[model samples]
Target: MFLVLQLAIIVLSFIAHEHEAIAAYVPDYSSLVFPIHKHTDAAKPLYSVEIMTAYVNMQYLHANFLIDVDAPFIWHDCIVQWNIYPGSCPPDKLCTSPVSCDEYQCTDVRTSYSYQKPYCSPPKNESISPGWGYCSCSVNVVDPVTGSCGQAKLNYWDDFTVNVSNGKNVLTGVYGVYPYAACAPSSAFQSFPANVTGVMALSSSPYALPAHLLEPLENVIGLCLPSTLSTSGVLFYGNSPYYLLPQKDVDVRSYLSYTPLIKHPDSFGYFIDVNNIVIKKRSISIPANATTKISTLDPYAILRTDIYNRVIRRFSMVTKRIPPAKPVPPFGLCFSTQSGLRVPDIDFSLPEGKKWTMSAANSIKQVTKDVACLALVDGGATSEPAIVIGSFQMEDNFLVFDLENSTFGFSSSLLRKQTSCSNFNFTLVES
Candidate 1:
C-alpha cells in the first residue's frame, strides 16, 4: 500500500514541479558482447565458454549484480543482506558509515518527501554549526513483509563479497561490490522474514540501485520471478543475454512483446498502458488512460474498489454452482478442491492489442490442501493507479524495463513456453 501523498503525484499534474522531478533518465551505453566462445580452437583448446567474459567481468567499471531468490510473492525488488568488510572504516566503530546531514546525497534523499522524510533532526542552529553539532541523515525505508515504512539512516555500504551466477550449472564467483543503501533499524526488522537485511531498491531514482547501470551496462533490467520457493529465479543487469540450462542455450529476450513505458513526472515507479481487462472471453472495460502502474510491494494484483468488485463478482457468478469456501483473510473468494473446478485466466489487454494473460498459476493461490482462492485484492475506491499489478501475478514472467527506449517488455509465463523462471539446475551437473 502507498501513501496518499505519493498518490497525489499521480493525480495532480501541476503540483509535480514543486518537488524534485523523477525523470525517466536515459544513458548512452556501448554494446557489450558476452560471447560464450563456441569453440576454443584446436591448438589452444580451453573451456567452451570465453575466458574474456570471465577476465572482463573482474576488470569492468561497474560490477553487474546477478540476484536470485526463492520466494517471490512475499519478497519484492533486489533484496540483499550486506556482510560488512573487516577493515572498512566506521566513524563510531559500529561498522556503519552514516552520511553527513549536510551531504549532497543526504539533501537529495531528504527531498524524497513522498516516500521518506527527515523523521528526526536537530535545531537549525545546532545542525548548521559544524563545530558543536552532528546529525545523521535519516530517511524512510519500506518493509514489504509487514507493509510498514520506518525511519532509516541513509548510509554508504562497503559491499561484501557475494556469489554471482552466470546461468545454471555453469559458474559462480564472488564478483559484486555495490555502494549506498538505507540502513533500517533492527526493531523495524522484527516483523520481517528472518535474515532479510535490506531491500536493494530498483526504483528509477538517482539514489537507488538502478542508477548504477551506466558505465559498462545498458539501462535495462530483466527480471524472472520464480513461482515456487523450492527453486530460484534470476535477475539480469545491462545488456547481458539470458539462457536457461537443460533447454538449450536460448535467449528468452526474443519472446518478449514490447509496450511503451509511461513516465510519471512525480514518482520513481514504472507505469504501463493497459487498455482493459478480459476474464475468460468476457471483457471488463476500464478507462483507457487509467493510472495503471506495476509494483513489487503489493502481494497480489490490487484493483480499484469498483473494478475489483466487478471482476471478483463476475468470477463468482461463473463458478456459482460450486459452493464457496469459508472466506480467506486476504482473498475474497475461494472454493474447495473437491469441487473439481478451475478458475478463469485474466487477460490484461494492452494498447498494442496484445493481451498478457495470467494463467491459474499466477491468478489462483492454493492456501490449503482443500482451499484454493482467487488471488486478487481490493484497493479501496479512488486508489491511485486504478490497477497495481503486484508480484503475485508477475511470477515466472520475464520482464524487461527498457528505460533507454521508454519501453516495457514482458514474457507472459515461462511454463507455457516449456520452461520455468526457476531455471535452476536442481540436479548435480558434472560441470
Candidate 2:
C-alpha cells in the first residue's frame, strides 16, 4: 500500500539558541508583540487586541482579531451608543426613559453619541437610524468559539478612532471597524483586523503606525510563527531584527533572500513568483514558456486540484506504493495507517534561488487513527488557478513583510522550540 512518508530534514543552520540562552537575553524595546492563539479546531492563528471603551471610566475590551493577509482594513463588532442621557450601551441593556428604545431601532436622524466624560466620541457620521449606518446591527448572533451568542447586542462603527497598542508601541489610526457579535463570546471579543498593507496604506495599518505617527525611521513588520502548538509566536512593528538573527551578535544580512511582492488592486493578499515544484529532488514538468501564475502566500493553503494531483503523483512514484484507501469525503487520497507509509521531502522553489522546504508533517494530515491523507486540498473550479502557500507550509518560519522595500523575507523561526511569548522580557508603554 502507498504510505505517505514523513520526511524530516535536519538542517544544522536552522537550529538556534536554546531556551535557557534565549531567556537570558533582554527584550528589545522598539517592537510590539502580539501573541498567536492557536485554536484546537481552527487551522489559522487568532491575534488579540485591546478595545478601549469610552465609559465614565475608560474600560478596555479585549477581542480576538484575525491577521488576515487578504483584507484591506480593520473590521470589528462594536457596542452601540445613543444620543440620550448616559450615552450608549449594548442594545440588550436598558436605555434611560424617553430614548424610545426597541430592538435595532434608533431615531430616524443620524447622530453621533457624545458621552459626558469625553473620553472618546463616536464617529460624527454614524447614522442613528437604518440605511444610514456604515454596517448593519445584529443581536443574539451565534458566537464562533462558544455556541451561546448570549445577550451581546452588536452594532457597526465605521472609521472608529482608537489608540491600538501592542503593550510597548501605540498605534493611533482610523480603522474600518464593524460589528461582529460572534468574535469569542465567552470573552468580550469584538473584531477581526487585517494588518497587511500596500505602499499607499502602510501608514494606516497598526504594523506601520509607529513609522507614520511617531518615529519616521521605523517601518518594517515581522511575524514569527512557531511550528508547534506547545510554543507561542509574536507579531512585531518597527525594528525587530533580533527575531530574524540566528544568534545574538551574528548578522543575518548575508543570509536573507528577498522577492518582489505582487500587489493586486482588488485584493489584499500577498502574491509571489513560484517557478517550480520540487519533490524528492525531482522537478515537476511545466511548459518552458507557460505563464507561471503568481501564487498567494495566505494564512490558508488551497491548491488547484490539478496541481495537487500532479504533486501527489510525483510523490507516489519515488516512495513505497500501495493501493489507495477507500475514498474519504473531502480528501482525494488516503492511505491505511497499517501501511506504514512515508512521504517525500517537498520544496517550493522561488525565482531567486529561494526554496521553502516542507517536511512530511507539514504536507500530510491524519484523518483518523487508521487513515492519513495529503493536506493539500483542491482549490475547486471557483478558486484561482494559482498556488496558495498556506500557513501550514509556513510553520516554524519567520516571515517578514517590509512595506518600505516592497519585499517579503522568510527564515527559520527563532523560537523553533515552541517557547511561549509571555516568557519574553518586554514592556508596553502608553503613548
Candidate 3:
C-alpha cells in the first residue's frame, strides 16, 4: 500500500509539472483582446470604433458578427405579403436550350441581348407575370419578434438591437429611434411594449436620430455611424455611394438629393461602399504542403471566398503535432460535403420577443465548428481537406470561442477593419 501511494504521488507530481508548463506556455489570451473605442472625428463622422479581435480561428468572427441575424422590429400595424413561387419564364423570354452541336455539353443562352422581348399576346401565359412578385417576410423592425425567419425573402426588415455585452458603459445613453413615417403604408406595423434593448446615445447631444446598423435585407433609410467617418468602406446594396447622417437629427426631405440604397434591387447581388471610408485589405499567410499547388492560388490574396471560391472561415493554430497529412482542397472548388469555411452573415429575421426566452423559434442560434485554416507545413506541397465543424445559436450577436480549451471559433473577414496591423497574420504548428 505504501509503494502504491508513493507511485501515485509521483504521478501527481508529474501532472502538476505538466499543468505548470501549460500555464506558462499557453499564449496570453488576454493579448488577443479586441479594442473598442469611442471615436469623435467630426470630419470622418465616426462615433464608434468597433475593433474586431484577432483569433486563431476566423470562425469566431463569423459566428460572433458576420453570421448574426437581425430580427425585424414589429412595424406596428403594418400588413405585408410575399410571393413565394412566382412561376416560370415570361412570354417573349427565351428559355434554356441544350445544344448537342457544341463539343462539350453547352447551354444555348439567349437574353435581352439575343432576343428582343416583344409584346406578348393578351391572355397568353398569364400565369407568368412580366416581373416576379417581390417576396416579403414580416419584420419586427420596431417591436421585434421572438425569432427571425431563416428562409430567404425578397423584401423584409428584421428588427434588431445591438447587444452591448462587454462595454455597455461606453455607450452611456445610446438610443435607437426610427421615424414613424419610415415604414409608411402603416397597415403592417407592430408595437412592442418594451423599448429597444441595446439602444444608447454615444452622446445625448441630440444631433438627430443616430444611424443604426442597417439590416442586410431592409430598405436602409440611412446609415448612422458615430459620424460619417469610416475606417473601412461601408457595404450597401448596390455598391453605390450613400449619405450617412444621424437618423434622429436629419430630415427625410434632405434625403431626396441622394438615392436611397435599395437591397436586392431589380438584380440579385452587388456591393455598396460608403464614402470617405478608407478600407484596407488584410493579408494573412496560409501554409502550403509539399504537394500544394501554389500556382493555382492567388498567392498574395487573403479572401477565402476569392481564393477558394466558397464561403468559409480560415483558422491557423500552432499545435504541438503536425497537421494530419492530407491533400489541401483544390483552389476555386466547392466542397462536396457542404463544409469548408463558413462565414456567418446577419439574418435579422430571428425572433427575440419580450422575454429572454430560448424556446422561441427565432431564438439566437450559435453555430460553431472545428474548421481548418490555411497552413504552410512544408512551403506549399499540399492543401488541407475541409472539415465538418459545428454551429450554435445564441440569444445575441456576441459569440464566444474557447480556443484555450481546444474548441475553436468562426467568423468572416468581411466586416473586419483592414489595416497594416501585421498581428492579424498567423502561423500554425503542433501544440
Candidate 4:
C-alpha cells in the first residue's frame, strides 16, 4: 500500500542476445569516471580556466549493484553491506586481524548479505577518515524458478558491481582565475563581462576556502594599479593609439555566473556503467524527429549468463499488498504493461497560480514490455536515456518531481480506463 523502495541492487553482465540498457538513476557517477574539462578565455576577457584537479583517479568508487535475471529459475536472496572505513583497511599489521570499529574510535563499519559470502570485512585502525557511506542492499526472490517466458538467466546477465575509490584526496583548486591584470581597461574581450561559464573539473574536493587561498594581498595587488604606470607591461599614451571605453562592468560579476558546463563524464560518457550495472527490459524506438532510439537486443546480452546475481524490474512487487523488506529505489525504470505505463506527454510546468493534480490514488504502471529500443543498426539512439520529461509537486499528501534525464510512460488505453488501476503500486506522495 506504500511501496517505493530501491534501497540498492545492481548486478550487470550481458553479452549474448544482450538486452538491458536504460540507466541514470544516479549510480556510477563518480562524475562518470572523472570528466569535466572546460577552460575558456578568448584571450582572458575576464577569466575562465577550470581544472580543480578532477582527473578521475578515484577518490571514490566503492561499487556494487549487480542485476542478473533470465527468469526461468529465480533464486534470489540479496542483502549486502560493507560501508567500510579503516582506510578500507590493508596496512598489514597482520592486516589488523579482524579489527573493525567505526565512529567509536574505529570510525564506521556495517555489514550485510547472506547468500553464502558476498564480501564483508570491516574493523581496523591506523588513521582512517574518508567520507560518504551507504551500504544498504537487499534482495529476496527465494524460490520461483520456472523459466520460459524467454528464459536465459545464465549465459550472462550482470546488474551490480561496486568497488570504486578516491575517497580521500580532498583539496581541489581553481577559483575563477580572473586576470586581465584584474580587469577594467573598461573590460572588453568581446562582451566579456566575464563568467564565461564553460570550465569545470570537480568530482568531490570542495569544502575548504574561507580566505587566504590565492594569497595576493598587497592591497589585492594594489587594486590593479594603473594610475599612470610608466612601464612593466606596456601602457603608452599618445596619438596613433588610445582606447579606453570598454568597461563592460565587473564586481566579480556579482560573484560569478556562466552556465553551460554539464560535462561530468570521465567514464560514463554516453551515460552509465559504473560497473556491472543493471536495469533491464528495453525496446526503444521513438522517431519522427522527436528523437530517441536504442534497441539492438544487446543490453549487455544478459552479461554472458548464469543469472550473475539477478535483476528483473518490469514491476511485480509480487502482486502483494504487503511487500516491504526494503530494496526499492527506481523511480525510473518502467517499460510498459502496468496498464501500459502512462506519461501523456506530461504538461503543466507550473507557475501562475501553480497547479498539478493526480491523486485519488494517482497510479500508473507499464512495469515492463522490455522496451529499450533504438538501434537502426546503431546510427543513433542509445545515448543512454538521453532525455525524458517528468514533473510533479502536489501537496496535502505530497508528490514532487524535479528530475533530470526524465522517465515515465503510461497508457495501455489509460490503464484499461483507470480505477487508479486498483493500486498497481506507486508512492511518490511526499509532503
Report the C-alpha lDDT of model 3 over 140-201, residue by residue, as the tens digit.
12211222211111113322222111111112121122321112132221221121112112
Candidate 1 local Cα displacement, residue 71, angstroms: 19
TM-score list, all predictions: 0.72, 0.58, 0.19, 0.15
Local accuracy by lDDT, each model: 0.60, 0.45, 0.21, 0.18
lDDT of 1: 0.60
| Best prediction by TM-score | 1
Whose lDDT is greatest here? 1
Worst 10-residue stretch by lDDT in candidate 4? 218-227
lDDT of 4 by residue, 227-289 (tens): 111211111100111111122121111221111112222211111111112122221222222
Model 1, 173: alpha-carbon shift in Å? Answer: 5.6
| Candidate 1 local Cα displacement, residue 129, angstroms | 12
Question: Quick one: how many clashes does candidate 1 have?
Answer: 1
RMSD of each: 15.2, 17.8, 29.4, 28.4
Superior candidate under lDDT, 1 versus 2:
1
lDDT of 3 at 92: 23
TM-score of 2: 0.58
